[model samples]
Target: MKQYLQSGIVGFSLTVVALLMPVNGIAQSIGSDKNTLPDIGVVASEALTVDKEMLIGDAIMRQMRGQAPIIDDPILSEYIQDLGNRLVLQAENTKFPFEFFVINNSAMNAFAFYGGHVGVHSGIITSADSESELASVLAHEVTHVTQRHLARRALSQQRSSPLQIASMLGSILLAAANPEAGMAALQTSSAISQQMTIDYTRSNEQEADRIGIDILYNAGFDPRAAATFFGKMAEEYRLRSRPPERLLTHPLTEKRIADARSRMARYPEVRLPPSLTFHLAKARLLARYQFDPDYALEHYMAVNEQGNYLVKEAARYGLAIALLANDKAAQAQEINNELLKRDPNNLFYIDLATDILIALNQPQTAVEMLEKEIFNKPRNSVVVLNLANTYLTMKQYSKTIELLRDYLLVKPHDQLAYSLLSEAYKSEKSYKGMHQSKAELLALYGAYPNAIDELQHAYNYTGDDHLEKQRIRARIQQLRDAEEKLRNF
Candidate 1:
């Protein structure tokens, strides 16, 4: 989150080629005597089993890691995941592990794919006027995953090969991030007519909206949020020459918005207080992700002075972030100190304070604060990652390595952890460890060959450690097998 990001090209180009592979019968409908769509539960599994869906999902997710501008902030991730899981708890037909992540894009879009992964763009958070609006969007995406809409789409083309199915699925996923490119891929990848895909996708949206509202209400969000958010979207984009990515993918019609209103009307009206964390999250994005430091500082200062924000503390939090970014670490620390005094256990304040302390050259103080927080919430990602970062700043390489190694047990796919571990290994002159960590980082981006090369370097750097050499060789082989698997798919 602190660092700017770059999407890789190598794996992305490979996946784009895969998206161009031809599918012969993707447009064909199921042979039904009644000319009716079959029940998804009965046939979706037959076409694309859960295991195959997950495999394709993993491959695409790895590519996205390499190609998409994904945010690696632990605090933001924790907040979004917590919010997503609350709605997931009320969802039905959830068959796989759900992962929530944010992409560092200024587009109003959210997408869900196979393997229960949902991605939100930063613009969606900034655009949302309330937590319930954000939650409504998440609930819709969750429904898409749980209902297995993508797999059901595959079920229509039962005569197609697995490779064709994988290509088609990949096209839909690609469209979520890059609409024009994905549309081209979809056209070449499938024989399915554009209208047909749109029709099916529209149907899926209707179903998702119906179920998402229930999930949102059951999760304690106002049901009317669904309709209100839809109205906001329609109004905002009504006369725009180019609508956002979400509108492109979702295709919001007047009927859709009206349907949302009618459906939400069934539930009794409810009024809820503002969400502090949601505003804080939005402010964090504004202060750190979107604007320059100086502009952010001025914006937050105005918000704080005028008290125009939904939450006062969130405005102050933004001010602190802007202060930190502007190199006013002492002022940032003072604001953070006040915030922490008010809510000593808030992870948001703790993480910001950690950054401020490190900036002030007080690594020991940051370490002491983070360590205490970690002791109380042993698995809290915010505290753990902050502590690991503090250790790296303190040049406690061994401690950094140890903490990240354990943290990876829970978040093996965390690219930031791998990067930090690699830095620590390099600083400690552990060439083998450094190469091994770098290998994992590359592998996460689907650069299997590069990963294998790094493992070989690790093996060469290995001393007389027979077990370590063997492990490196095994890892190299695993990457080779994975590369082969992806190639075939």
Candidate 2:
């Protein structure tokens, strides 16, 4: 699987560069503006087509999902996607749909790939002092996609060898997922013109920063958060010999910080209300991924002792989660109970409380809690997924299937939901259902060939069921066609 993914990565990178190479007219125009920034409008109008860009983006995302430690938590994924979609609504010239993902890495970095896919590291979320700061980072990455900066650079540097461009892009995608491997790729790729690439990237950085501030302001976030976050990154970079992955790609400089501050000064000072979800998300990341459970428990306990009420509450939440991770379910339950009393409607509290009930072997209580939430928010993915999980835990296979089938109709690509459905199918001893669910799960991870094979196995297992066999055959054909299309790329 590793080798298959790596080969796909190389092929996709090469295809992206080849498709982005400038035509004769574009090449001539680039020759005249060799010293200036490429006309973004010209590149936007005439460079890589949207279809090809989506294909490239999809390929890169699949490879990353297969290779990286992506956080598959539905609650966190839904939170980030909601935030990103809000910003996307206010963004201009958004040619593609935006998708957000969280990487389970402690390094402070966020990156945008082709087709509006943005990924933020868990560390960046935990490091943020305010929601606006996190929004600023996301806004910057969104601008990169909106402006088509990567495609423009690929076209402008078409004069370079194809091998060089592919190597550079491969390194970038790798760096976005794994910093060490990316650094190694950079060091080994002798064909790349390091200075030239850096200069181009620096220019794109400035443009993204300028436009990102506008997006942040328009989206009702504090624009100054961009400058604030940049300043913080700069200070951290100075103190460390090896800066974070963000500095490695973004390359913060004094001029950039000054320019951001200058731009932010034009907007009126408007303070937005704090978001509870932001605080909860940060606390969750810190508790779940950043430190050992015992250390996180101690750390949050110390933090809770001296902070303001909001901070203290957030710290308490983190401490509770850490305690739960350490298997102290009773203590965690107490904390969650208090939190729910304060805000019963908050999904964060409800979800954690449900998990606590399950951990304590009180599935009936969890069922009742989630059932009420699902009644209020019938179509909420987080609530639905949690309820499905609760049902699965109780060995209520039919209820699990019935609940998830409707939800998956709307969200067919959700791997976690499909995984739960697969378990439910196995518990019910439905071989064909199990194989079909497994196929869908594999397809979500971009293993199309494997998915086709799964369906073929399902077809063989469906003895004397002509309709089911025919359905499996048809699904296999669709998977094959999809695989062939990607292969052609």
The global C-alpha lDDT for each of the candidates, from Candidate 1 onward, is 0.77, 0.73
Over the stretch 1-489, how does candidate 2's per-residue lDDT look in tens digits?
Answer: 000111222111111111121111101211322234344645644545676667767766765666567777877888999999877776655666788988777778887766678888887898899999999999888777776766776566656443344445556556544556655765786533552353326667776776677778778899899999999899888889987668766878899999998876677796987778899899988887678988988888777776743655677789889888899989999998999999888887877887888899998898998898898888787788888888888999999999998998988867777888888999999877888999998887678988888788778789998988888888888888877776654
Predicted structure with the largest lDDT when compared to the true one: 1
Assess the local accuracy of residue 123 in candidate 2 as a C-alpha lDDT between 0 and 100: 78
Model 1, 206-279: lDDT tens per residue? 76777677778878898898888888878779768887667776879999998888776567687999998999
If scored against the real structure, what TM-score would every candidate get?
0.89, 0.86
Checking candidate 1 for backbone clashes, the offending pairs are none
Worst 10 residues of 2 by lDDT: 1-10
What lDDT, from 0 to 1, does candidate 2 have? 0.73
